[model samples]
Target: MLILLLAAPATAQPAPVIYLDQGWSKEDREWYYQVSQGSTALSYDLFLNLEVATGQDLFRSDANSDRYGLITQAANPRNNPDGLPIGLAKTVVTEGRSKGTYVGITCAACHNTQLNFKGKRIRVDGGVGNTFDMMAYVQALDDALQATLADSAKFGRLAGRLKASSPEAKTDLRKRFEREAARVHEYRTRTLASAITWGPARIDAIAMIVNRLTATLTGIPENTSTPLAPTKPPFLWNAPQATWTQWRGVQQDPIQRNLTETMGVFLDVDLQSKSPSEGLFDSNAAISNLQQIENLLTRLAPPQWPEEVFGKIDRKKAEAGKALFISICADCHNAWPYTWTEPNKHGKRFLLVGLVPQSYVGTDKGQFDALRPYAITGQLSDQLPPPLKGEKVIPTDQLYEALQEAVLAKALSKLKLTDAQAADLHGYREFPLPPKPMAVYKAAPRDGVWATPPFLHNGSVPNLYELLLPASERTKKFYVGREFDPVKVGLDTRSGTFLLDTTLRGNSNAGHSFEDGPLGNGVIGPRLSDEQRWAIIEYLKSIPEQAGRVTPFGGPPASPAR
Candidate 1:
């Protein structure tokens, strides 16, 4: 049988709640850091003039203050001693390498965060970060790089560093400089005008990935990325065990997902092939490097609610909330310890994530539409580089089918690898094809959900409190990535927000209303009362602590009629 964590019988909602705290081992802390701080090296660092304005200097510019989020004084300062910003993971690696040293942001750049409640600050690993503007950071780098090329002094500084390297290295650097210059120009001239503001802590991930892999690198004409569909980058906690990945359960393969994400970050992969026997192209994105990241994540623990920072939880309310959770929320937001055995010969466990269809969950359709079959299929080009001459296209609305067969076939052919070999890679790289794009989103496990504020796949609803409100009443425009409002349970977006108007394309906060289903009177689910919503939220805060305590949430099934 497939490794699926099916919920208990429910007419509409569904119920298997997995307790995650059981498997956590303290020894895995090192592994967690390794996974979280993925590659302190950059893919394009071999070419870019990063050495010229390295460290905080790269982030410091007149265009914006806050050092482009280069440093933060987070509560749990791991590996950092100077009271620098949390998740400012960047370092120069010059020790023992064929290629010269390189530097860039790591996984921690987006995944780690600091939660401040009252006067207390607590660092949360594997939590959604809100410090840096990923889009703006890229733009800033491009602008600074462009400036360096034009200025004699700055160019001299860059040249001085390259002068010590081999002539071939110098030549490669020159080529890369020209290539980067062109790419920056293309971005500014072609895409910048159309680029929407992602502010901070949010990104149109796939759109940017398309831009990096297809339009920018391939130098293709038709590959225009849309930044309009911005969504918050999700926290990476207990993902290896997740049966389904992505905001929607579209991605089943973990390795492929990581590789795609790494590629999106521009992992210096050269496509120009010199010989067929040598392989398609060279990339600094090594298989082992990515493997290390994947391996470490499997052992990573989700960030628990910081009792130290947030103070003691009201056990009575939490207990009441736990019962309430079983009654109202257990249908869709169920969890359980899912360990795959047959296919996964090694006994590996994961907290299975539940996927709910749009027709039922009825949250914002923008995120779903952004990642629809059409979105990715549209970016697929039917051309290959020299030596591996073949048409590479999805050619169908069958998104997951194309991902499993067509996409892999094209990738395997390009890499000169066989199907059986690819299969042996791991469960991480291997993916199951969904029959069709169900137009659904994962009813994401509530692990560490307390720490990651500004809820929803698109980061639309500012807080959990707001998320529980009627769809119509949810704040339409709020500033995201501001100070934390511990009482409100999200960012302090009441004022000085970027005016995230939901009326704009891909920014709707409609659907997933409380008290709207068969049981309740609303459309999406039940229109939850304030007390009921508070109860559920309280239980979420207690998830990490309520280990192995099975709450028999076997309530009467709501009428299945949607």
Candidate 2:
């Protein structure tokens, strides 16, 4: 019998997760998955009881989950005992009337990554989540809610889990479900469901946050604008050590960036209240939690290449590529062990990332242009401070920043943090720096960039090899939410659920060409041969080993001669 059982076909075990050395310990990594940023998606019990469109368990592997590229995580005692996927955090609502454990997505949802190469799963902590489709996830949630409401059997199963056996209990459960359903539906229709589908790894974060504040929270439908610019989430590994963060290099204060992010992810707030004392600026934005996350990020070293899994780097090719980097790439993407620095309160130095003009880099101006437009904010205009206070219309970027700062300032006031404590929390910034407008996108260091695929600010380019080619020669449309191509050093575009049509407005993969062409229109460098392209990629793979502390003069010049 034992021999017969052994001979029988066994179930295939899941591919073991291989984590890269990105500074976080096992405990730290687990904690990162569970820590709350105060953005509530749904009540914890509700999420647990929720069913998919097919009436299957929400957490079960299904077509929707597969299509959405949602990572399946196993339960562990240290954190995520409920087996929530990476970035999904459940926390009790401390201040809201809806006081219960609620499921919310943390920074990890968009920043953490897991790539498949020959069936091996390699996780990159703080790397770009190039697969998770935010739109599809929201749509699935909406579908589940609607399906449960329409099907009595589904509701019964959900009610049973919540112990709502009685008619009154069932009625209350239905009402609670309805409320959540409505919220999800509204968010999906208003913000996420766009004409240009934000496939995997791309979202118009700024538009969504602004709309959430000005339109949804302020009850001003006029303030809502269709989210037009969907860009991939920026990696967080070196973000804490950067003087200017975000793709735009507009955010100087780290906590402000965190607060903006949490708010975008559904940070519950009482922004509609007419009176200040009536919790007008009060929010569930967890400043302490944001601070914790920021601190952890400071130690997050970029993931180095796993030569065992990804194949060994060619040292000769890397040496040749290093020469090309100094001449062609160093100006925009600083040299490793970044020499240029600025002072910080933590006694650590922050790199001064290059801010290349949008016209100069010429890779999809949609993201930069998205923030430049003005919007007609309704009654919230009255709540604005100074200058634009009485104006009905204001710049979208400015308005959102003002509102975010106000809410954050109030949240800090409640904490009663000492100046020194607050400075520490702000990544050493003594006071919050108000966001400023810049027509440029950041050109940050690419130490472990080989691990991050779908290159460029808008993630239009698939790999380093393709990125080196002329823009016209690049893949016009390709699939995302698939495996990594170790050789190409980018996403496996051969198969995926989301088809990224680069021909679309915001989705254009144009600009940032390396071909021999006219100077402007993103033709930044001399064209390279296929060998040179591969050589550069080879060097990029070895960068993680070479990163850390080099003299400014010892490295290549910071800017190009152009």
Candidate 3:
């Protein structure tokens, strides 16, 4: 009963799913999918019975469809016990006024990826869920909830499913539904209204989280900033072992990264409370679960090229491409036998990811601009430290850092966790380097990168072939949510939902050219010929070996050799 959103005849056979060995057991995968990070999306019961605007079951309707990039899972007793797709979790609220079994978003929602290859589905556990359109999903949910509330028949249908046919029961059900519906409406308005069409596989995640922390949580309408810059969620395979995470390279600590993401997704918190006694900074963040997730991510490995499924690699072409990659791409993408530096207490070495300057890389600057300082004389001032407390303006990055710490601290305090326990929760403070706003984008190791599509931090480029072309020659617009093109090593831009117009703000595809031009502003090397481009693409599919040691690039020299 697994339904893939891909278009096909009713009599056509179901596409077989090929799950890559990304180093997760059945239990591990299940736990990863269901573990609650305390992000409430909707009440579980409501989500189960809610219908689309057309009166079709929401989960089965085109509105909740996988064609929009959100995977819809069928009922599975073990893999997906609740029958919700990866990244959606069910949890009971312990502290909030909306205390009940709620369906929330988890890390799997964005990180889990499924690629269609000639009617076959290839699942990449820790890869980017390039198909899920966060904005559209929220909007669809809002529409469904609104439809149910407005239509008496729809309301009656939902109530009947929940066994609330009695007059008093129906009244209570309506009240609960109204509250959640209002909540969903507000969220949709805040994130979707006037916001950039973050079509698929991208979001102004930091901006959204800051909006919630500064404006919504503190009830300071003036603190709000429209989410303008959307970036693709980074794949999680090697993230836990990296020196920094996120496209901006602004986060280091794994636990803090998860906490920030949880908040962005919808962690329930009361940061508006003016006094400590009023539960100021209190939240229902799943602190322990966050820690566990961090631990699990450490074991997650990037999916290697599956030759059996995706066809064999051309070693001859890959060999030639390796030389070309070393000459042009190695400095930024970092060829393996990587220099693993920054050894923590357990002697775990981290791969220092390169952070290329934005001006040079010449990708969209919206992400950097989003972190710039802004006026924030809001209720958050009371929670800030002495110097920032009285300041009229605060850098968004600094403000978010402070608030993340405060929220985590508050959550930890409520749990009565010991100092040692807290340290454990925070990944033993291994990645202690504080986050700072930098006008740079991270250059992650390109191992399983061939699997991630819609290239560039903003996801402006649709494929590696186009990415290698001069920015001016790149596709002006293309559709996402299409099947994977193994030959081109990216999305099949010919078909899909969400047409990405590169000319749009924050969607510029005008950098990282491999053509002959000025060294700066993204033209990094001599023009790569068509053969060269194809060779490199082939090499990427092969994913060549790493040396035991190599010098780092775009970062400080590797911790003086440990």
lDDT of 1 by residue, 226-286 (tens): 5567777787665655556777677766556766666555455443233323432334444
Worst 10 residues of 3 by lDDT: 546-555
Give stretches of model 2 more than 4 Å off.
1-11, 59-67, 342-348, 430-437, 546-562
Q: Better model by lDDT, 1 or 3?
A: 3
List the global CA lDDT of all models. Answer: 0.53, 0.78, 0.76
Give per-model TM-scores.
0.73, 0.92, 0.91
lDDT digits (tens) for residues 1-562 of candidate 2: 0000111132566666777766567788888877999988888888887889874666434334555776767676777777777778887776655567788988888898888899888888788888788887898888888999999999999898889999999999999889988988888987665788888888888888888877777777676778878898888766776668888888878788889888888788777877567778888778888888888877787877888888888999999998998889888887665755534345445665788888888889887665437777566678889997889888876787788888988888888888778778777753445455567889898888887888887888888889989888999988885688989899988878678899988888888888886776688888899899988989998887742222222123342222
Q: How close is candidate 2 to the true structure, as a TM-score?
A: 0.92
Give the Å shift of residue 163 in candidate 1.
Answer: 7.6
Best by lDDT: 2
